[model samples]
Target: MRWGEIIRRLVLIPPTLFGVAVIVFVLLRVVPGDPIAMMIPPGATPADIDRLRAFYGLDQPIPQQFVTWLGQALSGNFGRSISLHQRVFELVLARLPATLELALLATLIAVVLGVFAALIGVQLRGRRAEWIVDGGVGVLLAIPDFLWALILLLLFGVLIPWLPISGRIDPQIDIGFHSSFYLIESLLTGRFDVANALLHHMMLPALALALPFSALLARILKTSLAEAEDQDYAQIARARGFSRPEILLREVFPNALIPTVALGGVQITLLLGGTVLVERIFSYEGIGNMAIDAVINRDFPLIQGLILTFAALFIALNLAIDLVVTLLDPRLRHG
Candidate 1:
C-alpha cells in the first residue's frame, strides 16, 4: 500500500467511529422510551422512578449526560446494565467471545464456499452455467439468515438429531483450552471425536452464515472473472498456446480480485449491520445480542457503548481493507 493511502485510512477511522458513537447516542435519546420507566418494575411509586432516573443520570440535560457517559466510556467504564444487573463492560466481554467465534467460523465458511463457487463459475462460464449460478445466488441472498438457521435447526437438530439445536455448545460439555483444536489440529491431537462434534454443531450455523456471503462473493467474483475472460490479454495469452488454467490464473484472476478487494470494506461493515437478527435467531451472544437486549430494556448507556464498539470495529475493518487495497492497487491510495 502507498504510505499516503495507509495513513489516510488510519486517519479516517477515529472520526468515523466518533460520528457513529454520537449518532447512536443521540438517536437512542430521540426515540420514545423513558429509561426510568423501562427499568422500574410496574406499580413503582413516582418517587421510586425519580430516584432511579437521578441514579442513572436521566435527570441531567441530554448534552451533559452524553458527555459524562462518553468520558466514562472512554476510560473503560460502560456503567451498569439495568436488565442484567451487571457491569455492562463485563457482560459485553463475557458474551463477546461466543459471537466472535461464531463470526470467525462463519467468515471462514463463507470465504471457502464463495471461492468454490467462483471456481465453479470460472470453470463453467457458458450461459447455462451462468444462469444456474445467478439463480442460486439470487435465492440465497433473498432468504434471511435466521430463517435459514431455523430450517437447518429443524432438519439437523429436530429431524436428524445429529447436532445440538442452538447455543454455542452442549451445556454439559466443558469447553476450556481442550476445545480449541477444530480441524487439523484436533486430528493431530487425537481429538477426532471432539473435532467431529464441534464441526457437527458448527455446520448448520456456518452454512447459514456462508450462504448469503457466498452469494455476494460469488456474484462479484463471477462477474469480475467473466469480464476478465474477455480482455485482450486473455485472448493473446490463449493464442500463444498457453494452458487454459495458466491463462486464467496468470492473466485473469489477479485482475478479477481487484473488485473483490475493493468491496471487502462494505462486507466488513456488514458484520455489525447484518449480524443482529441472525444472532438473536440462533440465540448467539455477540454484540448483536447485546444491542438487542439494550434496545429491549432501554439501557441507554449500554446501548450507546455497544453501538460505538460495533461502529469502531466496522471502521477499523474498513480501514484494514482500504490499506490492503492500497497495497495491492496503489491507485486507490493516490485518489
Candidate 2:
C-alpha cells in the first residue's frame, strides 16, 4: 500500500510541476512590471527596449512565451535572471544550500525545544507549572516568526551584540569551501572553527524561525502525551510496576511521538516558507533572501524557478512524511 501510494505521488509530480509553472508564469506576466524596462538605462531608446524584450523572449505572446519557457524548463533550463544576469538554475542552486542549512538548523532547534517542553508538560500535568508552560507556549504562538526575527534582532543584535546578526558566516574567516554546505563541509574537513563561526551567525535567525513552530509542536505533543498516558498500554505498563519515567520512556513517549513526527514534517515546509522574510531580516545569503530580491526586481525567470523549486520540495516532503508515518505506525504498515 505504501509503495503504491509513493508510486502514485511520483506519477503526479510532473503535472504538479506543470500546474505550478503555468500559474507562476501567467501571474508574473499579468503583474504590471516590464523586465526589459527594469534592465534598460533611462535614456535607452524604444528600439533598445524592443531588442531586450526580443532577446529575453518577452516580445512573444503570453501563450507562446509560456510554451517556450515550459519547454526550456522541462529540459532544466530555467533561463537567466533579469537583474542578476545569471542563469536562474545556477543562482537558485548557489543559494539553496544556505536556505537548506538554515532550515535544518531551525528544525533541530524546534524539535529539541518542543520535545523538552512537551516532556516538562507531561511531568507537571495539572500543576501550577503546567499553566506557566501553557502560558509561555501561548505567547510564543501568538507572535509570527518574522516579528520574532525583529525582536531577536533588536535584543541580540543591538543591545547585547553577543551574536552576529547578519550573513551565513564571517567575511573575515576566509575559509575555502568545496561546496555551498559550509557547516557540513567545515565539519567534514575538521574545520571546527569555521563550523562554530557559522553556527554563531545562524543561531539567532534560526531560533527566531524556530520559536513559533516549537510552541506549536509542544502543544500537539503535550496533548498526544496526555492521551497516550491514559491508554490501555500505559495502564498495563503501570500495573507491571513500571515507574512513570520508565513508562514514558519505554512506552508512552514512542506512541505520542508518532503524531508529533508527522506534524513536524508539515511544519518544516512552513518553516521553509517563513525563511523568506526571516532571511531577509537577518541578511542571510539564502534562496529566501534571493527570492525577495527576485520579487523586488521583477526577475521573472528567477521568481518562477524559486516558486517551482519550493513547490517540488513541498510535495517531496509531504510524500516523505507519509512514508515515515507509515513506517512508525504498525497498523499502517500492516493494514
Candidate 3:
C-alpha cells in the first residue's frame, strides 16, 4: 500500500467511530428510562430516587447529560455501572478478553470453512456441487445465530450430554491465567483429557456463531472464484494444458481469494457484533452481555464506553482491511 492510502484509512476510521459514540451517547439518554430508578430498592421512596438521580446527573437536561458525559469520557472517566455498582471500565476490561477470544476463534473457523467451500465449488464444477454448496451457504446465512446456538445446545447439552449446558468451564476445576484455569493449565501441562473437555464446552457456542459468517463468506468467495475462472487468464491456463488444480490454485485462486482476505478483515467485526445474541443464549460472560446490561439499565457512561470501544474495534479492523487490500492488489496500491 502507498503511504497516502495508509494515511487515508487511518483518517477515515476514528472520526466515524467518534460519530457512532456520539449517537449512542444521545440515544441512551433520549430513551427515557432512569437507571437510578431501576437500580433503587423495590420499596424506595420517590425522594430517594430523586436523590440518586441527581447524584448521577440523571436529573440534568439531555444536553447537559451529553456534555457532561463527553467531557468525562474524553478525560478517561468511565464512571460506575448504575445496576452493578462496579467501575464500568474495570467491568468491561475484564470481559474484553473472552469476547476477543470468541471472535478470534470464530473468524479462524470462518476462514477455514469459507475457503474450503470455495475451493470445492471450483474443483467440483458440476451443477450439483454448485447448487448444494451455494444453497447450503444461503440457508445457513439466513438462519439466526441464536437459533443455531439453541439447536446445537439441545443436541449437545441435552441429548448427548457431551457438552456443558452453560458457562465456559467446569465449576469444580481450578483456573489458570486465562478463563477458568481448569482448561488452560490442563492443556499447557500436556493434559489432553482436560483440553478435550474444554474444547467440548466451547464447541457448540463457537459453531453457532461461526456457521452464519462462514456460510456468507463462502458464498462470496465461490462467486468470486467462479468469475475468476471465466477470465482470460484461466482460459490461457486451460489452453496451455495446465493441470486442474494448478489452474485453480496458481491462476484463479490468488486474485479471487486475496479479496476475500481483505473482506474477512472487515467481517471480523460482524463476528464480534453478533456475539451479543450468541453470548446471551450461551450465558457467556463477555463485552456483549456487559453492553446489553448497560443498555437495559440506561447506564449512560457505561453505554457510551461500550459503544465507543466496539466502534473503535470496527474502525481498526476496517483500516486493517483497507491496508491489506492495497498491499495485495497492486492496482489499489498505486491507485
Candidate 4:
C-alpha cells in the first residue's frame, strides 16, 4: 500500500523473473531429451545432429548456456523455438491474447458466481439454502480446474452437444482476423456472428476454469461477510432503521470486498496457470496450449519464454491487486 513498498515490489520483479528463467533453463536441460535430435530427421548422421545442436547453442556447457540465455533474454531476444522455428517472443506474443481473453472471461465469471453465492449464503443464513450453497461450493472446490474442463467437455461438448468443444473458433468461419484477439477484433469490426461464435466456443472452457475459483471466492467472501455483519457499524446501521438488505449493501459488502479482492487476485493467477491444461484439453491455441507442445518437443527456448511470461504476468497482477486493495481500504492507504 505504501509507495515505498510498491517501489520495493516493482524492483524485485526483475530478480524474480531471472530466478524463474534460471530454474526453467536448468530444469529443461536436466530432463532426459535431446531437442536437437528431435529436430533432426530419422537416420540423420551425428554430424547433422551436432550441427543443429551447435546452431541452437545446445553444445555449450550448462553455466555458459544459462549466462548466454539470461543475457539474450535481458536484451529481449528469447531465441527461436527449436521445434516451431519461430521467434520465441513473437510466438508467445501471438498466443498471449487468447490466454488473456480466456483468463479474463473466467475471472469475470468467477467474480459474478462467487459474489452471487456469497450473497445467497449470507441472506439465507441458518437456512437450507445456505447449506446447499455451501455444499455446492465445497464440491466445486474439491475438483481441480483440469477435471472441471473434462467434465464440462463431456457434459456440454458431447452429451448435450450445445457448444463447440475444440479450438478458438470454427475453422469453417473463414473470417479474416487482423489480431489474435478474435472476440475483441470481431466485436470491434461489427462481426457479431464471429463474436458470437467465439463466445460459444469459449464459454464451456471458461466456465470450467471459473468454477473452482468461484467456489474459493465464495467461501472467502462468505466468511468475510459473516465477519462484517458482526462489526459495530452494521449494528449502528440497524439502529438507524436501515433494512437488512440496506445494511448489507451499504455497510457490510464494501467491508467484505477488501479481502475478497485480494483473494480474487490470487485466484486469477491460479486461473492463468490452470489454462495450461484446460487450453490443451479444449485445443485452444493459447500460450498455455503452446507450452504443452513446447514441452513435448523439448523446445527449450519456447518453454523458457512461456514460463518467464507467466511469471511476469503473475508479478504484475499481484502488484496491481495490491494497489487496488490499498485504494479500496482507507486503513491500508495510510499504512
Candidate 1: 10-residue stretch with minimal lDDT: 175-184
- Using all chains and alpha carbons, the TM-scores for the candidates as numbered come to 0.87, 0.98, 0.89, 0.97
Runs in model 4 deviating more than 4 A are: none
Candidate 1 lDDT over residue span 1-335, tens digit each: 66776688788777887788778878878889877776678799989988888888878888998898878878988778777778888777766655566666777777777777886877777758767877887888788777788888788878888776565555666445433333444557776776676666667776777678877888888788889989999999999999878877888888888888688446746744666766776665467767888888888877876777677677777767766776667576555
- Native-vs-model 4 lDDT? 0.92
For each candidate in the order shown, give its overall lDDT on alpha carbons.
0.74, 0.92, 0.78, 0.92
- TM-score of decoy 1: 0.87
Model 2 alpha-carbon drift over 4 Å, by segment? none
Candidate with best TM-score: 2
Error of 1 at 29 (Å): 2.1
Clashes of each: 1, 0, 2, 0
What lDDT does model 2 reach? 0.92
Ranking by TM-score: 2, 4, 3, 1
Candidate 3, residues 184-272, lDDT tens digits: the string is 45667887766676666667778888898898788778778889999999999999999878988898988896767776667678888
What global local distance difference test value does model 3 have? 0.78
